[model samples]
Target chain A: MFHIYCPYCEEHREEEEFHPKGQAHIARPEEPEACSDEEWGDYLFFRDNPRGIHHELWVHAVGCRKFFNITRHTVSYAILETYKMGELPRFTAEFPEGSLSEKVTTEAEAMSRQEGVKA
Target chain B: MSNLVAQNIRTFETHPGVEISAESPLVFFHQRSGAPAPCTESRVALRERALLGHLILRGGAIVLDEAVHSVLGFGLPAYPNALSRDEGGERSIQWLSPDEWLLIVPGGEEFGLEGKLREALGDAHYAIVNVSGGQTLLELEGEAARELLMKSTPYDVHPDNFPVGKGVTTVFAKANLILRRPTETRWELVLRRSFADYLYRWILDAGEAYAIGVEV
Candidate 1:
């Protein structure tokens, strides 16, 4: 079984403490009444089934019972990083080949971008 | 009923005021399976701390900490997987999640404590759930107690991983319980009332080789 680092607990806990909750960052439509039937159906039922880098939502069911996101390599089963909700991931499909240092740089850039938008 | 209706939050005392026969969760197990008497040869000992007050506190840490400190004279455990106890050790608060904590106090004191906490935290977004009858605390001691736990849970029970004051809710055998280390030689299992018998049986079955006993 895989050991996962729970972002809230700040520790590596056994896999049994966590439950995989499909894809991460799927936002519900703000105006569902305005959307077409097909668009509504897509929002409700459609999810990415990718073989490479995947972002997943997981709940630490037994430990902290908090929901968080995991950026993982599906094929390699390597958890590149784990982050809390409302936080952006450093390693996405765009930076799939990014090294640890590259991830740090991008993470800083993402933080600055968020601040820029806020400002 | 009118007073309760006027209040936004509901709180109840599980313990009856009149003296009534109360059975611990392990009563059936102790009766049928029979507990071994603690002896010098016994490497592990188990005892149930029954009928204690179990309160689940849910709120922001700062607010809860302020109320707890004012009422209970202690603050909540600041770190995750940590437990903080009063100087006497009879009262304790264990961190369950970011917004949740478990406060356990001596029997017969919970109702008043809940009222005091509610008064201390007026109009704050918080909840206090009294769950005294729903669960019981079982204390395991002796040298082999840790070994008995290792056999049951996937959690790393080694002292290096589970140092004193660390507690976690984890799988125990096929069930779930809160495992905690209160002292160097003692471990506590907060077992649900329903699964206490099964867990007791599992512990006995696993600890047979170690000559485990029960201290009445």
Candidate 2:
């Protein structure tokens, strides 16, 4: 049983409270009618199955019921970091050192979590 | 923003008139499975505070806070997983998420309160849902209440981790409910109407060793 940290709830909750929603950062085409058959098909059916650092969407279904992102290592099955939606992750495929970074969140960064929401 | 959006939404009383009898979700279960009366030797006590007004408030915290404070006389819980209560302790606002809070008030006050809140919030983008009929609040009080919870849930319920005013929605047995510590010796369980019977039985079974008693 893994203790997954929910970004919105700001606490580590039991993994049973969450549901993993496949891949993260899948953007829908702005003009689906203008897309080619292959482009539309790729958008609808294609997904990356990376072996290393992977970012996925997950929802704290039982707790907060909010969707967030999780950066995890497929091989190690170690969660790198959990961040709110619309926030750029510090751990990515290019740079995956988030687990070692200080957990300190500055006031500015903390305040920025609601950048997309109506304040 | 006053009076702008009130007409856009239709609100009504949830309490079916006084003529029609309203039975709690557990009425049938309690009848079928009689509860053990509390005795001096009982170490755990379970009581249901049924049919209370439950509202799910969603919006920007600041906007909701001002309106809630004005209407309910208490602001929303400042931090996630925290529970804030009014002076009487009968009314509480629990922080469910960054943008959402759960307001539980005494029964029959929800309809009027919702209207007042809607009027106060005016045109602000927000949502207030009446969930009183959808859930029931069960309170556990006694020395072995913690032990009973420990046996049921994996969440840490130790005093150091779950002090008074801390509430969390987590897995308990095979179901999930909002578990909160309102006082030093009491813990509250907000169970969905559908899960109440199952969880009630589970709690009784898990608390059997403690000789849990039901306070009607």
Candidate 3:
């Protein structure tokens, strides 16, 4: 079983301790009033079911009880990244050292960027 | 007018196996004579009351360090998984997390001690919640207590890892408990109110082979 990382618990718990929440990187429409019906439909229902390197969200509902995103290989089940509820996932060639998504920056900066989002 | 004489008598039967003790901040249950105990009881191999005070302190440790040093005569422990004992060695405060602390004073003095801490803090962004009622303390003594805990929890409870004076919030037998060691022979389990009976029954079942006894 895959070991999922719980950001709140700050530990990699057994897969049994987590539950799949939904797709990640869901950006809210900046102006819903100005958007088309197709755009609204895409926002509401459309999601990527990618074969490899899919970034999906999961919740540590049984452990720390927090939501986080996981960049995992669907076939191999190898997780590339596990980020906190609101932070953006960074996948750059320069940062070749695959990190455990530690919050390496200031808390204030992270909090301000995610002001309207509910964690 | 002739008044009719009537006698009102109320009779109810309390089950002998379902013995509930007086309400304390915490309570424990254990069965005797190898008899089938109630479901609420943990059926633990052994159980006893841990007669110590427990208090939850919340605030920035850096800010509250000074007050704790002045009033308790010892600053907060620096280590994350450690506890600081007082001069008498009877009182201690364990760092539950970065922002939370579990303070244990002498039994029967926690309420007044909390008031003293409030006075000492003096409007700091801090909170001291009395959680004694929500939990009961179970003192697991005797030689096999350590082994029993190892079976109950996943954490390594060996003396090397869990030395005396250390406390940790860990899972124990399908439930959560704050485990602590006050002395060399004593181990404490801070169990929740709702799960006390379940845990108690589990303990009785586990400790049966060891010939563990129940204290009240």
Candidate 4:
């Protein structure tokens, strides 16, 4: 079984504690009404099945119960990296080593998204 | 249900009066399967810390932490998957996620605690959900307790990996529960009421070799 690393939990947990949530970084159109039918449909249904490097969304269902992104090799089945939501992936298709300019998610900025929001 | 409304949230006491009785999820299991009493040769002992007030706090940890610290007189666990306990050890807070923490206290204190936390958090982006009736805590102790846990969960239970004061929600015998090491000799399993029977049986079966006992 794959011992996947959960970005939120900050530890590697058993695969049974997690579930793959399809492709990652699929942003919802900022204004849905302005989008064309094809754009909306593609956003709703289409997903990439890249054979090489792929970024996927996954939830640590049983552990932290948090959603995070995972960059993995689809063919080799090796996990390249795990990152929390709202943060960009380092080992994308182009930059295998990592990108120099990545947004540093601070504790305050992360908490700002939660302000005034009731859960 | 109490008509007390705090911060537009309805609050009620699960334990209102002495007339209404409370039972652990294992009550049925004990009736059907029968809990074997601990003997001199028993190397494992199981005890249910039933009806503890369990709260799931969600939001920015900083806001929740301050509220919790003010209300409970203790702050949230400093790191992920860590457990922080009160001086008496009767109360604990476990870091479940970056934005979430699980607070467990004495059985009847939940209602009051929720009110205090809500009062402290006024308009802050936070949620304090009292999930007291949904789950229960089972504690395992003795020599073979680690062996019983090893058979059930894939997570490394060695002291090096899971030291004292660390708690994690993890898979156990096909089910998921909060696994915690509160102290060196004790391991706490916070099981959902729905999964308690199956896990109880699984623990009993796995611990049979070491002669496990149940303290009803």
Candidate 5:
């Protein structure tokens, strides 16, 4: 089982102790009042697909009851970092810099994995 | 007080465990005299206290790290899921979500610490909240402490998993807190203020077979 890092517990607990919250590092649009419908739709629906390090949000639902960000790799299912909900995750070139790219990669991989499972 | 319903809970009259009493704030419970006590105040033989001081430190790790190191004489842990502490282990700082941590100091030092952290952090966007009154502490000792914790919490309390100096904020029954094993024979349960009663009842009922008794 993957050892998941709980930001609230401040410890890497057995994966059973946590629940994945989804793609992490989401930022609300600046000046939403000035955005077009297409912009809003893209903001709501778009995501990135990557093969390596990704950022995602998770909640320690059974632990601290707090939301936090995590830097994880989809292939190895390895987590690089866990931070609070509102904070920006420190990023490196090896890892996609923000939520948008990470989300795109995550969705693409998830779909491919689902298809593989089906096949 | 008049209209509140009395909670019915099962309590043990005898148990093979250490009895820790409140001698003072920040005092350690001796293993020699550690035993659970029989209390009538709330039908809780072993009252799980919401103890000590709880402060949430929020800010950039680099900036907050400097502040914590300078002000508290300890550093904010760099790794996720890690706990940083003072020499005595009396005070501990645990990573509580990125850009945030939970610092447990002596019972009365929260306000001062918060002010100091703010000063040390300067204009960094950070937040520190004092939650001492909102929680109580319960010290569970004796051989049965670990087993009892397994019953109360889903997280593994095994020494292999939760070695001494390690602390976590995990689910306990229906609530949560900063759970730590500061001493070899002791387990500290930092509980919230409002849920103290419910947790007490749960512990007494679960610890019944162990003959758990409260000291103070």
Candidate 6:
């Protein structure tokens, strides 16, 4: 039940309007023919499962239908920021302290407890 | 005349010139479900604005705005999720995306409008898709219209969040449709030809408590 800010629509829309695309900032190799087998495999299958600060690609499926980036904390489920395509995220793993990590950790713990109860 | 304007772009009139009977998207629904008469007890009234011209215009906002203004006498909406209508409100242009807008006009006016827009736009990159047959507009009004919409869509229909002159493509029930607030009391739903029946039934089910009626 997350309310995500769509950069294109310039409003916070319900989560149902959005579809989360995998990891963000994963650029394709310029020359696929030049890459080795391992490099190509990594490009195709590898994705970071960072615990603190994670960037994700999401599309406003029901709204503007445009793709954008979201800087979210995995545990807390707090979306620190959402930016349009071709934009960079302000919060990154290197700057974990700047993100809402502490608050999200508590929220994540509470959410897990709720999930456990429901289960 | 349109052929000379842009060979790469394809534009066509969606309506036929013959006198054959045409049915709106809701014809079957109205016939099957039977419309309840509009009365003081009916809190919501649904009506179909059938056979209207619906065009999906894709291009740079500035270029499309200039061309639309030159042809339709009204520019594209300036902001996202905003709708601009003619003084008479018979024609409207709504911003669907950064580069996409929906232009709706009275039936029989779309083909000429598209041609004129092509001529006005010339070589600028653009696309005008006539979706008149692919979709239809349903007008919902009365006191319970907003509540009916809130039940169908997850998007907030509160007057504060969805003010007049705003439109958005959103999930409605199990389907997706375009929802617009044209006035304080009236809301419009643009449903695809395939999903109209499902949505109409869903609306009726949701509006039953309010004594919803279909105004044919």
Among all candidates shown, the one with the greatest DockQ = 4
The list of candidate 5 runs beyond 4 A from truth reads A1-57, A62-119, B1-51
Q: Looking at model 4 chain A, which ten-residue stretch has the lowest summed lDDT?
A: A110-119
Task: Compute the lDDT of residue B63 as modeled in candidate 6.
Answer: 91
lDDT of 2 by residue, A1-119 (tens): 57998888887888888999988878788799999999999889999999999889999999889999998899999898888877667787777765323443443256466454211
- Best candidate per TM-score, number? 2
Across all candidates, the chain A TM-score values are 0.81, 0.81, 0.74, 0.81, 0.67, 0.79
Q: Residue by residue across B1-216, what tens digits does model 2's lDDT show?
A: 244655598888998897997778899999997998898889999999988999999999999999998988899988989999999999999988888889999999999999999988888899999999999999999999999999989899999999999999889989999999999999999999999999999999987888899999
Which CAPRI category fits model 6?
medium
Instruction: Kindly indicate the candidate among 1 and 6 with the higher TM-score.
Output: 1
Candidate 6 versus truth, CA RMSD in Å, comes to: 8.4
Candidate 6, residues B7-113, lDDT tens digits: the string is: 67655556776886667887897787687777789999988899999999998988998988888788988899999999999999998999899999999999988
Worst 10 residues of 2 chain B by lDDT: B1-10
| lDDT (10s digit) by residue, model 3, range B1-216 | 011111222212211233753454323233223434223333333454554566888899877788778778898878665778888876778777657788777666776666667667766788777765566677777777887887777766889877887776766788767788888988877777887778877776777766666654
Candidate 5 lDDT over residue span A21-116, tens digit each:
667655557778898998887778787666787777777665556777777777877666776544445553343544565665576467556543
lDDT of 4 by residue, B1-216 (tens): 223344378777777587868888888888886888999999999989988999999999889889888988999998999999999999999998888899999998998888888788877888888888889999999989998999999999999999999999999998889999999999999999999999989998998998899987
Could you tell me the TM-score of candidate 4? 0.91
In order, what DockQ does each candidate have?
0.71, 0.78, 0.16, 0.82, 0.26, 0.66
Candidate 1 second chain TM: 0.95
- If chain B of candidate 2 is superposed on the true chain B, what is its TM-score? 0.98
Residue-by-residue lDDT tens digits, candidate 1, A3-106 = 89998888898898789999997878879999999999999999998988999999988878889999999899899999887667778898886546666767
The sequence of per-residue lDDT tens digits that candidate 1 reaches over residues B114-170 is 988888888788888998889999999999998899899999999899999999998
Better of 3 and 6 by lDDT: 6
Clashes of each: 0, 0, 20, 0, 35, 1
**Positional deviation of A81 in candidate 4, in angstroms?**
0.8
